[model samples]
Target: AQSVTQPDIHITVSEGASLELRCNYSYGATPYLFWYVQSPGQGLQLLLKYFSGDTLVQGIKGFEAEFKRSQSSFNLRKPSVHWSDAAEYFCAVGVREGFKTIFGAGTRLFVKA
Candidate 1:
């Protein structure tokens, strides 16, 4: 069975500051990893994914993540954040042969001006 854990339930960041969200997973095989963001009253959008090579992967809105196999971690990072970036971020692990996905509780990002 595959599972994911997100330590932070919420985070606040001043506009233009850096951001990092933690993630950890447990799976028997190589799992499909993904980070998604959802704005208020909006659908979730894919930020990035890790399936194969290159431990570090970049995504939209100036977001990036590094997949660490040893630590079973995949943490999201941003050099600088904007007020518009305030939203709920979820760390999920995808499994083959299933349409459903297991999502973490989520980290709600608050952007301060």
Candidate 2:
């Protein structure tokens, strides 16, 4: 079985401040990890992913994540966050070439002006 956990249910950050969202996973094998962002009423958009190779992977909208096998973690980070960056983030884990993907509860980010 595969599962993802996002400990933070909600986070508030000042505009232009650095931001980090924590994600942890449990899987029997090397799993495909992903970070996705969704607006209030919109569909999810892929922020980044890690299948193999480099531990650190870059993503869209100035986002990046590092895959730590030892810790079973894939945390997302941004040097600076904007008000527009506020959204609900979900961490997902899936088997390679498998259709089933398990997503975390999600972390909602609130940015203050």
Top candidate by TM-score: 2
Write model 2 residue lDDT over 39-61, tens digit each, in one string: 99999999999999999999999
Error of 2 at 66 (Å): 0.5
Give the Cα-based TM-score of candidate 2 against the true structure. Answer: 0.96
How much lDDT does candidate 2 score? 0.95
Tens-digit lDDT track of model 1 for 1-113: 77899999999999999999999998877878999999989899999999999999999989999999999999999999999999999999887757547788899999999
Q: What is the C-alpha RMSD of each candidate to the true structure, in Å?
A: 1.1, 1.1
lDDT (Cα, 0-100) at 23 in candidate 2: 100
Error of 2 at 69 (Å): 0.6
Error of 2 at 38 (Å): 0.3
